[model samples]
Target: MAVGRNGRFSGLLVVAGLLAGSWTGFGQEKKSEKVVVAGTPAAAPVPAAPADSVTDGSVTVGGQVIAYRAVAGTLTVGATATQDATIGFDGKTLPDAQVNSPDKDKPEDAPATARIFYTAYFKKDAAAEHRPVTFLYNGGPGSATMWLHMGSFGPKRVAIPDAEHQEGAPYAIVSNESSLLDVTDLVFIDAPGTGFSRIYGKDKEKAFWGTDQDAHAFERFIRRFLSKYDRWNSPKYLFGESYGTPRSAVLSADLQNVDLNGIILLSQILSFDNSVDGPKWNPGVDQAYALALPTYAATAFYHHKLPTQPAALEPFLAEVEQWALGEYMTALLQGSELPEAKRQEIATKLHGYTGLPVAYLLRANLRVAGGVFSKQLQTDEDTTTGRLDSRFKGPDLDPLSGDAEYDPQSQAISSAYTAAINDYMRKQLKYGEQQTYLPGAYSDPSFSWDLRHQAPGGPSATEQEGGTNVMPDLADTMKANPRMKVMLAGGYYDLATPYFEGKFEMHHLQIPQKLQSNISYHYYEAGHMVYVNEAVLKQFHADVAAFIKSTESGK
Candidate 1:
């Protein structure tokens, strides 16, 4: 099931909205402590995190710059290369998490942690001999990589049922059939202050918090990982959901500076402020209109099934985009004084476009919250309101007119997955630690959502800059490594990072049209985690397997 992503908790948006640090999965918190360095590094001063210095493209030496020192070392798989699975993040070295019973008699005091420890899952039975290795993470800006890690794709998945709100046993997670692992090696990196990752005092904190700083940190992390893994030449891909989607977009260019292949965005959110577009006085008022359009149509298609074939949605959306960007944009700009003629016209079109009544659009003045349509679209006469997520509706005692009965979608999305993450951490992970996974309020006020808007024309000299667009750099990588193939994935109903906005960047980025065929993007019907739909999962895995096998693009 997908999250009721639109019915955002405006307050929680502020937390992730500000830090831009490590927002993957649900959320993450890391303990930040600096380490003293000793010994010398075998390499030269890295102007940036050089990709070839360490194995796996990552390093954990104590000192920085030319004074490179080994604070951490490698622990190659002890197995007979029989398709490695388990991994451990023990400081000073990496280790295999092989265990006999798994349930230890008494778990030792958790080791003193350093370096936000993370693990990777390289699926066995290699589906592709020369498969592309994908790096996946979720979006919390404060989240740990665990969400997408164990919960979704990782080798050892979180224990949860496939459907929402399953009873008997808290959750049961298994190998994700939709996981790209069948064709790719997946690495989950914990961002600073979340998971085992942490801040090294205030100095390090400053660098990992803001937009630019966060990008640089991720850039450095990727470089170090490539070096540590010794896969600098391998075909590399990155995937992220929600906030992680924007992180992947920014990192696409950031990693290109150091050299990376291509990028994939899942439920993307390109700009913090733009996601909620509107006049300065009432932010997001305009964007709210656009965001509500797609899902409304999706619901309409779901309920009415007008055109018969689901594929028929494309023509309708093509028209919705035209109206939203054109007339809808124009009307929202017109405050109370919409000439009677234009009002009637817009109201009628709104009714036809979104299966909602023209009276509602007229009363709302073309500005309606996503929640309103989600419930109103399917509300019954006896039941005045339905759940916020039209996806989930149940009969209720209390009846309401304006507000939704409840946030069924949010609760459903949280039910199975949240329980699974906790189980996966304990059982499969063998981390004996027993702690409940806290799925933050769908709209917790504590989460950061407030940040200064980007300048009209991107960043200026006076303003700070970190992770912005570096699509051109990725283009350069393709130019250098013509052998590599790449893919990009987008979600159609994603209000956070509208697929249309992402496609616009290629126009802004300077790229030779001939080389463009190497990177191809495929869209899905689901909201963010397209894999949630078993049908989509079947197709997504097949496509990823084909791409990793070097058959994609006729290459």
Candidate 2:
């Protein structure tokens, strides 16, 4: 479970990489769509949902100053109160088991055990339930919602000197005119154990830390949030990055009983079958290499490393995609049985596309893994391209190592996000949480996470033989909710969850042929966190705004 600062893999280098809108007309289309642990508390009663702390704010976007209300609050889930699992600086337990679940479907005596913390901004004058509401979160399995909260979708964003440089403090906070606030309401949720959220007990941590359980908790939280705010009638959307993409997919299935308008998957890693650095001929290697080739080409093109640079990006990408799926895939499927001359030809062609040396490609059996490419691509310059964003380069700490030492892309903007989130929560939003805001990186102590999901038998069954792969979950969700539309956004340089992998997953989602068109793909010139690139950020906003508009129009 490699997790990066914003949307990186659990152990992988940080790569990084929002919005909302409309309804009534789309509602006519008739359709649409789509955590944790804690020990069993004593006989203590469950608490009601926490009162929301509201603050008024205004931001001028697209020449309009939209007045809005920002509500910072805790929404309780489960059957008992949230306990402070924090130790007294020495790992001592501080249990506060008074929080309770408001399970309307269960008995009044039903228990509640966890509390979710969220910040919501809504246009004050807009129609309450008519405006679209997009719930946003980042994936670290351990990450908080801060990245999307302050970096992209929120009204205020952190200003960095440049996305490729270390944004040292004191960083500036500026208005994110590109924010989706103008088109939709936003609610940024800090996943349990991240940000101000907490579960009642240590034992409960395992429950919230897993795949299916995590989605269940979020589903409950969204239902409760809607009930509390009287937003059940609003057009709902889910926006997730990195690991959050899988969570979004599973959540869509969990909420299938409810109508969901759309889903936004940014920098998605829906399938974990792909490898970054490993033996190249494993069971999943063919699929992994095939999916990665186009991205390798994209990165090589970005750096002008390809033998013959194409004049334009899209047509060049089409060429790579065609090769990756055609001859490249056939060669990989042949494996060791292939003739040396054939392997040599494939290796030479791979070199032409990936900018990796033909000698190395031949040695690698014509498979150039991600980290290998990241380190070897710029060998002459003694630099390592970031696994998160190959466009960002750093010193080659261990030039001999197979992987990039650390993600320069993660380091580049970490300071700005950390400082901005801390300031925005306390100063502007008037949030009073005293706990540290965890930025869901793998380095965090609490980030020790579980990737297991309940066996196919149901939520209470044994583990599935193979580990987590949520592609089926997303496909099933789409199948069950045909009206729900999806926008899969990818950054050409995002090695962590390469754009080509997303395309592969979408193509193989195993849904109906008609349903296949339900998911659309968009590419950015940036990396995992495409919004970090200013131009891409604006384009992201525009693209997503259009997506939301389209979904509402049922087109």
Candidate 3:
């Protein structure tokens, strides 16, 4: 999720996070060690945090006791046998290695480039090289995976009463019976400078701070991970959230050498064109308005703001979709050219659908941005709605302000997740690192990101514009691997990455009609983090389980 300039929670993260890149062929032979040339004088050593102690744990699920081991450690990347991978490196073959061990101290002889921290859970009963392994990460470009790690699919989950309410502190974590472990083993990743991941040596932040570079780093990590654990032949899947959705798509396209059985995208934003148009209405395209209308209707319906509320979300959204594409699209296309009579008619309907006053709708010229709708929706109560999940509301200090003071959507869950992950690392997982865990870095310079990405097939301007939009790369990946399957999960209440945007991207993906059936979509009643709501999570768990089984069985 994008942390806004004023510390409010925004839509998809615009800032790019650091991503380490040392691309090497998974099957390539290891290079011989070379002498290290000391660069500048070494800085004084700071004592390392106590080493992570590998631990064993068991949880009972479905009447079965599943034994698992939790391993926490730093995985080294972007380093050559002797020299840093960034030093004297060509574009091709970024000969790199990854060492996932409990010890944090760097070996005197080992090459250190970047250190990535991760917490892994391996099922003891599963066959060594047969069971499926899924790699999970969240998107901020700068966000740690803790949201998905502690709030959703992880074995232990942070329990909050509701997304609309804050949790009382000294909060607690509960065993997630719906954890994906019931079907597949899981690994949660923390990219550089997030959580405990760090960059070493003289390598610049640019190495892992861009799109292609980030994907390449993940590719290196996945390859090295499979090789290290002897799971190269194991069935693989990528589970990514928000920005991680685009990251997953790009990684799927880039890892042509490594076969991925399936991909699960949560709160996906496949294209930036749709995302950038979310909070604000961008001119020249009816796509954004048409897509966002359904979410606006859903949020309005949830708050009972809609003049004519439907009994159910599905029917309400389905009706809104029709109007948004039909009358709404036509009126928006006309702009000022629309007649006063037609404008009044459309404004009335928009008010009915969005709960914004007809006069205000007319004042907006028939387009109400998400933020404006959020603040205006609850103006009577002198509160503002959340961008993440409009179901949540908070009082703005300055009620007269047009914008929301803060995102109640972010505030509603951030504390529970932040507290749960920190406590779990030291208490449950036995990670002894004294380093402060950064859930997200809003102001960190390293989090200042560049979105430009190298196109998959060749140099193309379409790929260059809005570097975060990886729809083309995803389409290319599907074309190359016709058998690769994708399951997209979106929230109807999610204004951040509206469900209709996912629908729009799929329609415009340009994949051959025959291969189109390989992609599937699911919708939830909750917002961006769909799993935060337990009822929705049950459906999420079931859908994921069925998808994993179907893909693994080659169905």
Ranking by lDDT: 3, 2, 1
- Clashes in predicted model 2: 33
Clashing pairs in 3: 16-449, 19-208
Q: lDDT per residue, candidate 1, 376-494, as tens digits?
A: 66555433222222334444324565644344434444545555655654544444243323333222222332222232235552363432333444455556656555566655654
Model 1, residue 21: distance off in Å is 15
Number of backbone collisions per candidate, in order? 63, 33, 2
Give TM per candidate.
0.66, 0.84, 0.86
Candidate 3 has a TM-score of 0.86
Query: What is candidate 2's TM-score against the reference?
Result: 0.84
List ranges where model 3 is wrong by over 4 Å: 1-52, 79-112, 276-281, 460-463
Residue lDDT tens for model 3, 1-555:
456545543443443311122211011112233345678345333234345458898766666678888888765566432333333221122435343321334333223345567788899968968898999998877678888898787788988877567646877798887787878889899876678776544343556755676777787777667866789888899999988988998889878677788999888877665652332423655567678889988998888987877888898788888888888888888877999999999989888888899988888788766667778888999988877777888887578887565678786677777788899998878784567887764445434455667667656533444324688888888888788899999888887778888887887887999887998999988988888888898789889988999897556
lDDT of each: 0.48, 0.72, 0.73
Q: Which ten residues in a row have the lowest lDDT in candidate 1?
A: 45-54
The global Cα lDDT (0 to 1) of model 3 is 0.73
- State which candidate, 1 or 3, has the greater TM-score: 3
